[model samples]
Target chain A: MKKEMVCISCPMGCHLTVEGEGDNWTVTGNSCKNGERYGIQEMTDPRRILPTTVVIKGAMISRLPVKTAQEIPKGKLFDAMDELSKVVVEAPVKVGDVVLKNVCDTGIDVIATKTMPAV
Target chain B: MYDIIVIGGGPAGLAAAVEAKKEGVDNILILERDRELGGILNQCIHNGFGLHTFKEQLTGPEYAGRYIDMAMDLKIPYKLNTMVLDMERKDDDTKVVHAINEEDGYMALEAKAVILTMGCRERTAGAIGIPGFRPAGVFTAGTAQRFINMEGYMTGKEVVILGSGDIGLIMARRMTLEGAHVKCVCEIMPYSNGLTRNIVQCLDDFNIPLKLSHTITFIHGKDRVEAVDVTQVDENLKPIPGTTETIPCDTLLLSVGLIPENEISRGAGVEIDRRTQGPSISELCETNLPGVFAAGNVVHVHDLVDFVSQEAALAGKGAARYVKGHLEEDINFTTVNGDGIGNVVPEKITVANLDDSVNCYMRVRKVSTDTVINCYIGDEKIATKKARKFVPAEMVNFKIKKSDLEKYHDGELKFVVEPKEA
Candidate 1:
C-alpha cells in the first residue's frame, strides 16, 4: 500500500509518498529525511495541537482567552477542549501559567497567550 | 479646503480615507498619482491575502477592491493622477501640500491635516550589492510581477530569483504557471522570511527549491543576465569558500525586500526613524510635525494588507481629530524597542487620557521558537504574549488595551520578546 503525507517539519511541506508492507516502508518525494518520519507517523497516528481561546473571569472582559501550549494528540483535541471549557483562570495570571494541567492525562497544558491583570 | 488630505490611492490610502470619514471627518480627499485607483493591488494577481482581517481567502486585487468599494460608498473625495511633491505644516491647524496633476502641472493644496500613506518601493539588485554589469533582464520582483500580471509579458524563459521573500516565492509559482522555468530561490538567511503558508503553496506545491543560507555572489551577463553564481554563507552572513555554484539562467529576479517610501516625509522636516524609514509618530500616528500623520507602508512594511488597513484607519481617525481641534499636543509616554525586537512604530504615546487601545507593530531580529513578547511601561510589564514561531519576515503585532496604558501613567514603554520555557 502507498501512503502520502505533507511534512510540516519546515515551511517546505514536502509531499512524502511511501510504499510500505506492514511496519516496514520505502519513501519517496521527500526533500529531506524528516518527511519520511512524518509520512510513517501519518500512516500510524496523526495528531495536531489545538490553540483556541477559553473564557476566563476576574478580568476586564467577561472572558479571558487561553490556548493549548502545544499540540496534543489529534484524537484527544475534543476531550482537551471539553476539559478547557470548564476551566476558568484568575487575572494577574502570567503567560505560561498552566490553566489545565495534564488535560485528560494527554500531557498537554492549556496556557494563557496574554497576561491578564486582577482587579 | 478639506479637513484631511491623504496622499496615495493604494489600499492603505483608500482604507485610511474611509476610516477617517467614518470617524466624522467629512471633507476628505485621497490623492492618487496613478491613472486609476487601487495602487499596487491592480498588478498583483495572486490569492493569498485577507485571511486574518476578513477570515476568507482573497487575492490582492480582491482585497483592494473591497476597500475601494467601501471608500466609494462613503463618498470619499479622490483625485486621480495627482502626485504630491511636498508638504509643510504652517501652524497647528493649517498644512500646505504641493502637488502636480496630469492636466495641471503644479498646484498648492491646503488642508487641516495630512495622512501620508505612500506605501513602499521594492529593493532592486543595486541595493543588495549584486556585482554585475547593469542589464535589462534583471528586474525587481514587484516589477516583474507587474510585467507579467498586468502587462501580460513573460519575464523570461529561465529565471533565478534572489531572496526567498513572499513576492519572490509567489513569482516563482507565477512564472512557472506562465511556462517559465524557475531555477531556484536563494536567501542569505537560514530560514524562510515569508509566511509558512506561502512557502507551502507557492514553492512546495510547485516543486521549487528554496536554498537557505545562500546568496548570489555575482551575476554573469553581457547584454542581459545569462547566469548567476550563488554561494553558501557562514554564521555572520559572509560567503563561505568552496561552496560556490553557478546556475545558468537568462534572467534574475530580485525579491530582496521593500523599503518604506518616506521621501516626502523628509522634505517636510519630519524626523524619520532609520530603522523603519518612516516618520516617527506617537500613539496617535502623528509625526513630529503637529498636523501631519503617517501610516501604512509609509510607516513600515506590513505582511498582511489587512494590518495596513487597520493601522491606516487609526491614522485616519487620528488625523480627523487633529483637524477638528480635539487633539492634544502633550504626549506623556514614549514607545521604545526592547531586546530581541527590531523596531516599534509610533515612537511616542500621546493622548494623555488614554481611551482606546494602542497597537504596536514590530519585527524580530532573528528566528525564535516558543517566545514571549513582553510590553513594559518602565518597570511594570503591561502586556505579554507567547508566540510559536518568530521570524524577521513576519511582523509581530502587540495590542495594548486602554487599561494597560492607564496602569503606567508616564514613562518609556518598551516592547521585548524573550524565549519562553518549552
Candidate 2:
C-alpha cells in the first residue's frame, strides 16, 4: 500500500509518499528527518494537539479556552471533545490549570491556556 | 503634551508604547478602542503565535499577555474605550489627536509624535461582490471567530466557507470541532491565499475539501443562507457556463482578505499606497507628515505578529528620536519593485537615519523555489539573498545594511526575485 500526505511539521509542507503496511513503512519525498519521522508516525498512530474551549462559571467570560497538554490520538478527538463538553470549571483559573485530568485515560490533561478572573 | 501618543492598544500599539518607554520616553499613552487591551488577540484563541518573538508556541491571548505584562511592569499608561476621531498637524508641526469615550466625552491630546497602529479588518462578502441576498448567515471569518471563540456562540451547523484565507481554514477546524459540518472551502485563485500549514493541519487533517479556482456565483435563501451555487473559473476568473454546482449549507463564511484600517490615517492626509491601501512610509516608519509614524497592519498586512512587533518597535524608537530632536532630515532613495516582487514596505529609505540595517518586508508575486532575491542600485548589483522557497502567502524580510546602502545612495534601489539556476 502507498499513502501520499503533506508533512505538517513545518511551513515547508513537504509532500511525503509512505509505502508499506502495518508497522513497517518506507517514506520518501521528505526534505528533512523531521518530515520522515512525521510520515511514519502519521501512517502509524496519528495524533494531534486538541485545542478547544470549555464552559466556565463566575468568570469575566462564559467560556474558558483549554488545550490538551500533549498530542492525543487523532481517533479519540471527538470522544475527548465529548468528555470536554460535559466539563464546567469555576473561575479564578490560571494558565496550565488542569481542566480534565488524564482525559480518556490518554495521560493527556486538558489545561487552561489563559487566566480567567472571578466575576 | 505627551512625548508619544500611541493609537490602538493592540499588539502593534502595545509594543510601540513599551519600546518608546524603554527608549527613555517618559510621557507615553496608548489609546485603545476596546474595553480592554490585547485587541484582536483576545479573540484569537489558537496557539500558533509568538514562535519567533518568544521562541515558544503560544496562544493568541498568551502572546498578548506577555506584552501587556511588560507594559504594566514599566508603568505605561493606556486609556480604554477611547476612539480616536481624527489626527491633524498644527502650524507648529505638533500633532493633535481628537478622541471620544463615554467617560471622557470629548478630549483632545497633544503629542510630540503619534504612531498609528489601528490594525486591519476582514474583507466582507460585499467587498468581493458575491451576488447574494442580505442574509443573517453571512459573516466574515473574523466576526465568526469572535462569535465562537469569545462569545461561545456557534454560528451554524452546516457551513460553506468562501476564500481559502488562513482564518477561513482555521475556522473550518473550529467549526468541525464544535460539531458543525463544513461543506467545503472555495478559492477563486489557483493558489491558496493562506499559509501552507493551515491547508495541511486545518483542512487536510479534518477531511475538509478545498476547491481551488472556484467561487460562489449565487447565494440562495432570503432570511438565512440555504445554499450557494459554486462554480469553477478559468484563468481570468470568469465562470464557465453550465458548471455551477449548488452546495447546501446554512452558513456562508467569507474569509476573502484583510484591509488595513486607515480611516484616521486617511483623514490625517497621509499618503496612501494603492497596492497596500495603507500609509506610505520611510524606513523609520515615518509618514510624509513629520512627527507622524505608522506601523503594523496599519502600514501593511504582515503574516506574522512577531514582524508586526519588530516593525512597531522601530516606529516607537523613531518617535522617541523625533521627540528628543535626534532624527535627522536626509535625502531618501525610492525602492522600486522589480521583476517578481509584488510589493515592498518602507517605500523609501534614508541612509543617514538607519541604525545598523533596514529590513525590507516584501511578498513575491508567485511561488518559486531555489530563488535569489537580487537588490540593484541602478546598474550595480548591491546585495543578493538566497531563498529556499518563495511564496506570496509568506512575507520575506530582506535586510540591507547601512554600509551597503551608503555606498549607493544616489539612485533608486530595486528588488527582484530570479531563479538561482538561471
Candidate 3:
C-alpha cells in the first residue's frame, strides 16, 4: 500500500510519500531525514504531543497549560485529557513541572508549559 | 521619566525590552493590560515554536518564558493590568504614554523612546458580516483558545469553524480532543490561509474535513448557535445560490484574519502603512517618528514568533541608538511589493549595516509553483530565492546583504515573484 502524508516535523511542511507498508516502508519526497522519520512514524504507529489544561488551585489563573513531556500514543490523547480533567495541583507550578506521571501507561509524563505563582 | 517605554508586554514587547536593556538602555518600562506577562504566548500552548530563535521545537509558553526570564534577569520593570490609552509626543523628543490601572489610575509616563508592540486581534464574525443573528456561541478562535486553555471552559459540543487560518485548523483538533464534534472548517478561498503543517497535524490527524472554496453564508440559532449555512463560492468569491448546506452546530468559530492592533500608534501620529494596516518602519524598525519604533505585529503580522523576536530586537536596538544619537538619518530606498505580493514589511531601508543583514518579509497574493522571488533595485536584479511552492499562508523571507545594497544608488527596491525559467 502507498500512502501520502505531510511531515509535521517542522514548519517546512514537506509532502511525503511512503511506499510498501507493514514495517517495511520506503519514504520519499522528504526534504530532510527528520521528514523521512516523521513520514514513517505517521505511516506506522503515530504519536503526538498532547497539550491541554489542568485545574490549578491558588493561582492567578484557574487552569494551567500542560503538555506531554514527549510524544504519546495518539490514540491515548482523550484518555490523557480524561486523567488531566480530574487532577488539580497547587500553584507555584513552574514550567516543565511534571503534572501527571505515566499518563495512561504511555511512560510519558505531562508537564506544565506555563508558570503559575501562588495568588 | 524612563529611557524607553514598551507598550504591550507580549513576546514582542518583552523581547524588545530585553534587547533594549542589553543595549545599555536603563530605566525602561513595559506596560501590559493583561494581568500577567507573556501575553498571547501564554494561551498558545502548542508546539512548533522557537524553531528559528532557539533551534528547538518548543511550546509557546516555553518560548515566552525564555524572554520573560531574560527580562527579569535584566531587572527591567513592567506594569501589568495597565492599559495604555494614548501615546503622543509631548515635545520634539519626549513621548508620553497615558495609561490607567487600579494601582495607578490615570497616569502619564514620559520616555525618550517608545516601542509599539501591541500585537494583533482576531477578526470577528462581524468583520466579515456573515448574515446571522447575534448568537452567544460565536467566538473567535483566540478567544476559544483562551477560554479552553487558560480558563478550563468548554466552548461547545458541536462546532463549525469558518476560515482555515492556523488558529481555526488548530482549534479543529483542539475541539476534537476536548470531546467537541467539529463538523467542518469552511474556507472561502481555493487554498488554505494557514501553514501546511497545521492543516496536517491539526486537521488531518484528527480527520476533520477542510472545505476549500466554501463559506458560512448564514449563521443559525436564536440565543445560542444552533446551525450555520455553508455555501460554495464562485471564482470571484460570490456565494452560489441554491447550494446552501446547513450543518447543525452549537458553536461557530471565526478564525478569519488578524489585524494589527495599532490604534495607539495612529494616535501617536505615526505614519501607518495602508498595505499592512500597521506602522511603517525602516530596516532598523524605527517609524516615521525617529524615536518612536515599532516591531512585530504592530508593524506587520508575523506568522512565526521567532521572527517577531528578531524584529523586536531591531526596534529595541533602534531605540537604544536613538537614545545615544547613533541612528541613521538617511532613507536610501523604499520597499515596493511588485506583482503577486502583499504587505511587505520594513517599508524602507535606511542604510546598509555591517552588523546585521536587512531582513524583508512578504506574503504572496496567490499560490504559485516553481517560482523565484526576485528583488530588483530599479533595473538591477540584486537577489533571488527559488522555492518549490509559494503560498500566501507562508511568509517569504528575503535578506539583502550589505554587499548587495552597496551597488544600489537609491529609489525603489521592488520584490516580485516570477515563474522559474526553463
Best by DockQ: 3
Interface residue Cα RMSD of candidate 2 after superposition: 1.5
Q: Any residue pairs clashing in model 1, and if so which?
A: A49-A71, A56-A64
Residue B290 local lDDT, model 1: 86
Model 2, residue B214: distance off in Å is 0.3
- Candidate with top lDDT is 3
For candidate 1 chain B, the 10 contiguous residues with the lowest summed lDDT are: B42-51
- TM-score of predicted chain B versus true chain B for each candidate: 0.97, 0.98, 0.98
Q: Arrange candidates by lDDT, highest first: which order?
A: 3, 2, 1
Fnat per model, in the order shown: 0.04, 0.46, 0.86
Candidate 1, DockQ score (0 to 1) = 0.03
In candidate 2 chain B, where is summed lDDT lowest over 10 consecutive residues?
A: B327-336
Error of 2 at B236 (Å): 0.4
Proportion of true inter-chain contacts also present in candidate 3:
0.86
First chain TM-score, candidate 3: 0.95
Model 3: per-residue Cα lDDT over B10-41, one tens digit each: 99999899999999999899999999898899
